[model samples]
Target: MSEVDEYLRFFPYDEPYDNQGEAMDRIHTSLERGQDVLFEGACGTGKTLSALVPALEYARDAGKAVVITTDVHQQMRQFVQEARAITRQEPIRSVVFKGKASMCHIDVGYEECQVLRDNTRELVDARQEEAQLRERERQLLSDAQDGEERAVEARDAVVDELENVAERVQSISSEKNVCEYYKNNLTGNVDEFYEWLFDDVRTPDDVYDFAEARTMCGYELLKEGMEGVDLVVANYHHLLDPMIREQFFRWLGRDPDDVITVFDEAHNVEAAARDHATRTLTEQTLNQALDELEETDDPRTKRAANVLRPYRDALVEVYEDSFGFGERERVGDNWEDVAVANESGRDDLTIEFLQRYEGPGYKSDLEAAVMLGKDLDDQYEEAYKNGETTTRKDCQTLQSAAFVGAWMREGTDEGLHPVVSVRRDQGTDEVYGRAELYTCIPQEVTRELFEEVHATVLMSATLRPFDVTEDVLGLTNPVTMAYGLQFPPENRRTYAVSTPALFSSARDDPQVQEEVGTALHDAVRFTPGNTLVFTPNYAEAERYAQRLRQQGDATVYLDEAGVDANDLRERFTNDDDGVLLTSLWGTLAEGVSFDGDDATTVVVIGVPYPHLDDRAEAVQQAYGKAFDRPGKSDPGWTYAVEIPTVRKTRQALGRVIRSPEDIGVRVLLDERYTQQSRSDMGKYSVRGTFPPEERDEMIDLAPEKLKFAMMNFYQDNGRYDGPPPAP
Candidate 1:
């Protein structure tokens, strides 16, 4: 569309989806004006072309940067595959961006890698040899019925050599060629070999040199011939999180506002931003760090110890105040600042030291400090000198306090974004710390990131109680838009207030359980399709789901019932007539989608309300009077937290009926649908039985309610009639 020509070109599509051409036309205009575009398409509305295809076109024609950001990585993969199919031989420059940890870094030379491998291999061989020698000596003695002192001594000598070799191998330092960024930064030397080892690695084998997730960006940034890169696809973290934005996409240049950013499933913005802003670290982690420091003499090992001592001392001083032994109702609101206020805990001081502590050979000190993980610290010098990949990314890495996730995006007068991460230190086995941060009231991040971006397009199917999201995000003034992306009348049925008092303080009337069971049973009874029941809390989700399951209702429990994300994906993908009962609008309720015949009916039980958290009281007091008036606000509900959650429900309910031909049902159990929270539900709802109208034609009201509704809904609309389907 611009002056740039012949850089790259892909054949125009002969056939495209209903909206692909129109979508690309909008994009062409957007590129012409240098404006950002947010397109919200219903599930089957061909969203990829709106930005994906257009971005590629823009990358070829305008020579402008194009980024496709999606919270869901799987969608990103599908997008990449589609792009590859379209531009099989086109010169359209494209690369997937991922975090630094995702790629493998040849941080060490081949010889070093080989030396470490060979030495370790030798140690293993020597040990095997010694073991065989001892076995042989024993056999010899047994065969002769006589003890051979010389043979036994020889076995012992071999064993000793094996041990010595192991120790020697363990003495040198080596690093795991785990991620390409690390390889690019450390081995690429960033100086002499930038063009050699530092360029991006395009194929899958090299992408593994990145991260477990194989996030989009890492694939592109570390490509073997990364220059002249055209389109860079990434997630919000890569574009919004400064540390990530600077490190991964900086290669593309910093002016993102000027760059075309297409947010796929953009509606995840609020929750995604909130999650990115949350900070967490723990005492167990700090202690382990201290332990790691004592294991090696590598400069990084020593530097970490030096950096931690002052903080340790300061922690001891404030320990009595910030923490107490048992479940002592979480610390105060501003405890984070208070913990670091004592000169020793000053973040700036600790950060300065962490950033500069050079390694033994004057390499990046941060790289060296990473080696001090509790499990592998003792093996640091050995791994470094040898060249082996270590340092954790999964559970072990979770314990790290690297950068400690502090935020100073806003200052004291506006409000301190103070947060104190705490959890039942259920030991290392089940440690879960929850962090709360008001990024809008930044306490640690650079405010320039938010203020300088030219335009940010936040679009998700559901960002509910928009005002509440605005209040928490402090972005009430942004241009807001919504699309009525409803499922087809023949595709889905929705029931409002299907059951009475399913979960609430007043829900314990014994009969309520039987009633819930009966309703849930009917929801799943005849239909072999998957059924998802959303509850209000973990306990309630557990209670109702357990009740239904005890009667062999064939249900999978979602969150609040001790169910997690894995469990959700399982139930969504499992065979036994997949049925899931979970907290309404929980994480799973909001973020996951089940396509095809995987889902049929989603039952929402009660409104999602945040329980009384440590800071809930203060938050309620601050804006509760102004917005939550009369009996409108419940202390049990952090409207700040819950409203966003209900929006999650809206999204979950949207998952099943992805296309017009797909049939599904949404059942809301909360009687509150007749009252106040009803407003929150409607604002973000894609399809449902809107109250006052109460029950839709597809909504079944009683005993025969479910069976009759299912029959009719399928009578005319079920096209997958190609065969029997999940009920």
Candidate 2:
């Protein structure tokens, strides 16, 4: 058998799908050549197995470990399941690393956890020292004879020292500030736990349950057991965040060169990278810092707070000027302004303004703030140890100081934008100032990571337009593979209807919304199972939901901000024919499966473009400056806006059909998608943005005919039982 066939033995199935086999072969080839692979396979292409099988085979032979990073807990659990299947065939060890907060048995925050661990370590060290002294004293007493004066003196002195040490140990043991879980982990033998962890592939939940029963720290066990593991699964932050990545690699005891990394759902890498790099300092944070300082008796901390006070005022002034809150009328009951505040409250603050503002000494004050914050942090720890406080909250003063320091250091970096915004308290209409340093370019974080790793495989169902991905992510000449949808073409139908484009200018027009809503109502009524509607934003989602509730017979569920999505998903999935109305870039749009009879239709109301706020405009301008050329037509908009929007639309489309056995209908309720010609499509055309396979399957029809076509489709698929609905 060939090398690819050999790898297939660990595929955990009798036979691989055609796309799966092709993907495996290509990924294996890329790995062998020491090149990264960008694999784009549709929903039914067995992405997890295809990526894992080759990665495992290559890593096992190359004396490397496979590090798999996902975007959600479900994906991580899926990885664990796949790893277990591979383990049954070969005895490879795999472990899942969850965040410390999740794996911790105690109900404390991150800073508290650190404090407890520190105190526990001190106690354990003191006890060990006491034990050693007692052993020495016992030996001395045994050796000293009744007549030997020098030996007797030595024995007596050692006994006295042991008693003092014992007292210290007792004092430490009696302290209530230590983490018993961490203490147990430090003192108890974990060889059996390690053996059990390595015996089979384990999920984070499994590790948590086992460790909880044994009264041990699961995070510590996973950290210590990483030496010989063949595969590791973790969330994106474990690999994206710089400090966390450093600690993660330390646990693995391997350099980037010794590991093969796979970024599942790799389209999210850009956003994840940006999120990790973004920093914000709020007015409340500064006030809390002042509060902390006021409570402290130390003169140094008080002086630091004094320095911070003026800086806070300066920051607020910047926000006020940037947002023009003083100039605008405070229309309390204006629905539009409220929506604007709820949707895009941020306004641009030029880097030059931040650099040139002379109201306060930004650089000097911020630097001093950092130093003072560190001093205050040390003082707080000292106080905690002395039992001056019942509990220790995180030092917001230090946090604020660090944020300002970071802004000062990296604010002017290309692709990083400074913005000021206001937050209105819900209980009271009081507005507070907030500042953020947004990282617009994923390349800032991902370029170094991908370059340093041995090889990376970025697989997603919608990671198309390789040029955009490569340029934005700063990938070198990597192998690219795009596979068509593996499911039967007959099982799926996509229609780009003839409704007027719901562009920002036309979305509020009652005529356009009614037509779009009418098309969705029909689609929901005709689809046998559940239907999912994806809008451009929450405002649009709510508008369409109202229309559907008024006109359609199906139960309409709307996704609201700050609501628990899991509960909503459970309710929707349990319904027989419920319509879930949500926006793109939400929980339901990606990393969620609506397989089987859960959802039979997904309706995209409009092209889900990035909100055109100050940040987005700044990013577009930055991309234009970075990648624009004389002959290229709007490369910046294409890269920064259009491509990502198309990816979100496709992510929503992929939600309904998860396997070959699943049948689904996709509706694009806008004329812009169908009006574009493949030959002369503009940079902003939604249809032009789609991958070729998706474009090929799309059929354009008038809005009134959408329900008829859907009805015909369901009937042809043997799912429709009732008569054809009126269009």
Best by TM-score: 2
Task: Compose the digit string of candidate 1's lDDT tens values, residues 1-727.
Answer: 4322211244334455545456556655555555444554556555665455556665555555666678786777766765665556454556666554444343443334434444544544544565665676567556445665666666566567657655544443232223333333332323323242234323343455443233322333354334456666676787657666655545666464545566666556644664566555555556666765564454556655554444334343444345557534554332333223222233332343345434453223333445544435334445543445442122222144343323222212122233434344434333233323333322123224434444344445554445444544444254443344444565566765445554455678777666666666766654547777776676777777677666775655455434467766765677647676665545566556677777777777665655655344434443454355555545224454455455556666776777766777776665455443346545323223231222233243543365566656655565334543334
Q: Model 2, range 257-321, lDDT digits (tens) per residue?
A: 88889999999998899999888888889889988878866656645665567657766566555
Give me the overall lDDT of model 1. Answer: 0.51
lDDT (C-alpha) at residue 238 in model 1: 75
Q: In model 1, what lDDT does residue 387 have?
A: 48
**Candidate 1 Cα misplacement greater than 4 A, ranges:** 1-31, 89-91, 105-206, 209-226, 278-417, 421-455, 464-481, 501-503, 526-528, 553-576, 584-587, 615-639, 674-708, 715-727
The runs of at least 3 residues in candidate 2 whose Cα sits more than 4 Å from the true structure, single-residue gaps closed, are: 145-157, 160-164, 174-176, 291-307, 318-362, 385-395, 425-430, 561-564, 675-681
How much is the lDDT of residue 280 in candidate 1?
52
Worst lDDT 10-window in candidate 2:
334-343
Model 1 Cα shift for residue 515 (angstroms): 3.3
